[model samples]
Target: MTGGGAAGLVGLVLVSHSAAVAGSVAELARDLAGAGRLAPVEPAGGTRDGGLGTSAELIAAAAGRANRGAGVAILADLGSAVLTVRALLAEEDALPPLARLVDAPLLEGAVAATLAASTGADLDAVTAAAEEARHYRTS
Candidate 1:
């Protein structure tokens, strides 16, 4: 989680193809947290141009850095990023037990999940909601 109290319920992770996107993800998550939602924002991978995309090794390392050091809801940018995330999940001896995959609208999903998390939504619930989200408009 990111916050100190109930806010730390669900941790948010942003995996993008651009560093700016990652930063934006973190920022938006933070905003949601500030609004009394979820935990703090945790972002990994994604360089200034997000060259890392979704390399398993990179996602592993990044996932390893999330708050609470446990399961996280990863929000990706596009289909390619999703593929990379899938690849990471299928890796040999992945992060295991701690981290899991959460598919939501890359940007909107991240935002909603982070905000919902602020309200103490479980990782699974948030992931399900995010995945069900349709045609989310960007901020």
Candidate 2:
């Protein structure tokens, strides 16, 4: 686990309706970041029954695993997934101390967040990088 401090590397949690999607994005982001020794990057996707939906349990568990005492940035795919995270945030002590739900495109945001975290960026900077990825032109 990375040390907790102003310069500590933030952790990332990727949430999606489909388990495959979240897992794939996490893997891709890790590969893109090129930081083999980076902090935790977890994927929270699908329901406990293996159906397509958001799982609060999974999200909370993933956040716990990802949090390296530095903080955690969460990016969700679609509306319901975002709402699930929001509900979790509304509950006291549902997630890690600094867990935040970032509003950004899922794939791009995960990659951007991972890249920033890999550089030992703080939680705020990691979330900012993910949010800023929304403005990036793909053309």
Candidate 3:
């Protein structure tokens, strides 16, 4: 685990309806950010039964695991996934204060968040980066 401070790298959690989607997104984000730069990028997708659905328990667990004592930023692929993450946060009292859900496009947001976190960016900065990715255009 890494040290916790203003300069500590923030962790990332990717939530999707499909486990494969979450895992693939994490891998892409890590590749885009360069290897060994990002902290724990855990994927919390699918339900306990391996079906296509989001699980609040899984999200909460992933958040806990992803936090390296610094903080965590969560990005979701769908509204339900976001809702699940939010519900988990609201229901879990032990969740870290720095952990937050970033309302941004999932793939772009994860990529941006991962890159920012890789640079030792603080939680707020990483969340901001993820949100900023929402405005990214490729025209």
Q: Lowest summed-lDDT stretch of 10 residues in model 1?
A: 1-10
- Candidate 3 segments whose C-alpha is farther than 4 A from its true place: 1-7
Off by over 4 Å in 1: 1-8, 35-38, 47-52, 67-70, 96-98, 135-139
Best by lDDT: 2
User: What's model 2's overall lDDT?
Assistant: 0.89
| Candidate 1 vs candidate 3, lDDT winner | 3
Per-residue CA lDDT of model 3 for 3-111, tens digit only, reads: 4542367889999999999999999998898866556788988997999999877888888788776788999998888777777677647456678888989899999
lDDT of all predictions: 0.65, 0.89, 0.83
Candidate 1 residues 13-115, lDDT tens each? 6877776777777886677557643464566656434475555666666666554543567777778777777787777666544466676666667767776
Q: How well does candidate 3 match the true structure, expressed as C-alpha RMSD?
A: 3.0
- Collision count for each candidate, in order: 7, 0, 0
* TM-score of each model, in listed order: 0.74, 0.92, 0.88
Whose TM-score is greatest here? 2
**Root-mean-square deviation per candidate:** 4.1, 2.8, 3.0
Error of 2 at 64 (Å): 0.4
